[model samples]
Target: MFNKGNKGLFALVLTLFMLTNFVSNAQEGESIFNSKCATCHAPHKDMTGPKLFEVRQKWEEGGAMEGSLHQWVKNWQVAAATDPYAKEVSDWAPSAMTLFADLTDEQIEAVFDYVDEQPKGGAVADAAGAAGGGVASNIATEENDFGWIWYILGAVFLVIIFSVGGVKRQLQELDEDADKQVKVGSKVWVFKNRKYVGIGVLVLVMAGVVWLFLGLYQIGVVSSYQPSQPIAFPHDIHAGINGIDCKYCHNSADKSKSAGIPTTNVCMNCHKQIQGAGDQVEKIKNIYASAGFSPEGGGKYSGETEPIIWNKVHNLPDHVYFNHSQHVEIGGIDCKQCHGDMTKQNELPRVVPVEELNMVEGNIQLTRPTLTMGWCIECHNVKEVSTGTLEGKGGYYDEIHKRLLENDESLYEEYLEDGKVTVNELGGWECAKCHY
Candidate 1:
């Protein structure tokens, strides 16, 4: 009886301990989720990553979720095998997620537990609706923006009216003074008031010189110059409508100085199978012919290939050094931020006048930022850097955070409070960041 009682007491204590641990883990999972996973994934809604609630179900049904989740979180390729779900998810988001092998088991459990408890309907619908609404609003705003054009037209009309009135008044004054003995002839007027005439001539000469220099300074600047491309590469179709990643075609943006143009082979990789381009197939066939291939059927040719030479519309001067990777990959700037909506244009349009003067310059297109250096400075000044530990978004900012910690310990401490650091605070505006 005594031994049995002792055994029962021990079992009771063990059960209580397990229950406490489970509850503690659940809370910790909530905290971990809010910090890391919340940025890209939600329990029931899709953002950059898929909805977590459905992921488990999909994984189990597809025979992928259970074993692959852990491996996928650690290394993408490891989970890719025998994990159809993982492959599908990765396809949806071409960018690889940052590895999270550092996360503790307790943290992972907490994340899963939190995901299990998320209320489903509201979150998913709200996110989808908001995304759709945002796109519609953006289109509506662009369509309705005639205010600036109207304002300029009105100002021009006012200037013309004032100039006509001034000319009429001057004629009236001349007629009233006609009877005076002083002649209106140029030689007589100059002789009568030689000092006034001389001053006026000097003023005119100085103004003309200033105007000439200013005009010369602005000669080579082409802000809104839309040139026709060899192949009407529609940015709107590739980027906006089809949702092809900017990095997909311009693969070098992340790895090299130039966002290298896509090779003809890259085009053939997709086009070989998709030969008929819905009336665009004929245009695509020309590309295949240039690359020495028969699109109607597989006809192998001698290994000779000639690439289509695209006219580079945006050429910067040799003196300035600008790396596309640094801005797009490291700084996390969207291609659309600079290139605008490429999909909307049938052919790549000259970057709007606003962006041209603001961001480009020179026959070599030096980094003067035609808009104003102050505008570039302002973006660098106000934008914040992401901290690696932030939820959902991958931790690309860790290296930057370390640099900040080394230089400004006090600022680093403040950033720790919010778990983020802004780009401005981290020396983003330094001339060397872009100019050098």
Candidate 2:
């Protein structure tokens, strides 16, 4: 009886240990989903991919869950061959999901376990709600600037001071001339004075030179240059309120040079279902009209579709080469870093103020930075490349870092002491990186 009790106690302890391991693995899977899949997929909602909440159920009921799940995760193409279940999921999402063949069997199992435990409707709604809040906050912060009021007040004060000084000077001159009772300093006499004439000419020449240099510096630069857009699109509604991902609208940043404008078909994907106008919807409808789409009835016309001619806001000189991918993909710079909170802008306004002196000017005023070569180098020198993580995956810089640590002991020790290698240290300031 004592032996039986001992065996039972041991079995209970082993069961508890296994359960704890399973829970830990499931939590890690959630982290993985948050980092990578959350951008495109959701547990319940049919987003870029199928509703993942019922993925396990679909796979299990179809009789290919275990083996197909393993293979589909490793390589979709390989798994899709014999796996009818995998094919069904793929058919739902026409766009091929990027394969994560590198993940181990254990990791894939953890992901499945996480999918099984996810609460229906709750996870998707919560994620969408959080994203909406972030967009709204960003828009609000941008719109609340008091810089323009201050600028007008300063100009008014300067004008008042100048007018007062001019009146006082005129009165003093009149009194002096009356007391003297003589022709006080004729215009010709003043002009003939070598000292005064020399000073006048010197001032004019200096002003001309400064003006010429300023014009040359501003030659190709366009600051505060808001042009009329085809669609009077309000970022506040789409990005801020609706909570669309910037990447969704500007999809090419991940894989290509340009964040190419969304095609008309992309617009129809959502706009077709939602035709009712709420102030900004008419603007969105204009985009449809330009693409030869009639919202009244009938489907898209087969005739020549005139693409909406959007005036590009951020224009770089032909000589300069700027790649959206390099900054976005490699450096992981946010779109808001350069473009400001576009969600707050109600109308497309011309950019002004050639040089940005502060965050107010740089972000709100839509001013171009004094983008001299030195200024570019200075930014690169200060900015640190976060070798911490890549799009929520493990840091891609880790391999290079490991090599540096193992091969160069002194350099590794110094880097550890400093806590980081700045962009400049990693040759980010090199001319070729930007110029080429």
Whole-model alpha-carbon lDDT for candidate 1: 0.56
Residue 261 of model 1, lDDT score: 85
TM-score of candidate 2 relative to the true fold: 0.48
> Model 2 over residues 66-162: C-alpha lDDT tens digits?
6787787667877887777777777877675556655778877676676565556553335533453111211221222123324533543354344
How much is 22 displaced in model 1, in angstroms?
A: 82
State every prediction's TM-score relative to the real structure: 0.46, 0.48
RMSD of candidate 2 to the truth, in angstroms, is 32.3
Q: Which residue runs does candidate 2 get wrong by more than 4 Å?
A: 1-204, 278-281, 290-292, 296-304, 349-375, 388-419
| Residues 1-436, model 1: lDDT tens digits | 3232223334433443443354455445643454345545656666777777756566777767666877775566667766787887688877655456556665666678666865555442344334431122222222222333355335434543443344345445555676774765653454456457446544543554354335333423445645434566667766777788878888999878998888988887777776654868767867777688775546554566666756445544322457776667666766655665455656565645544433433211224443344435666654544644444243556666666667887878886665555666666666676563
Pairs with steric clashes in candidate 2: 223-351, 223-352, 224-350, 224-351, 224-352, 225-350, 225-351, 226-349, 226-350, 226-351
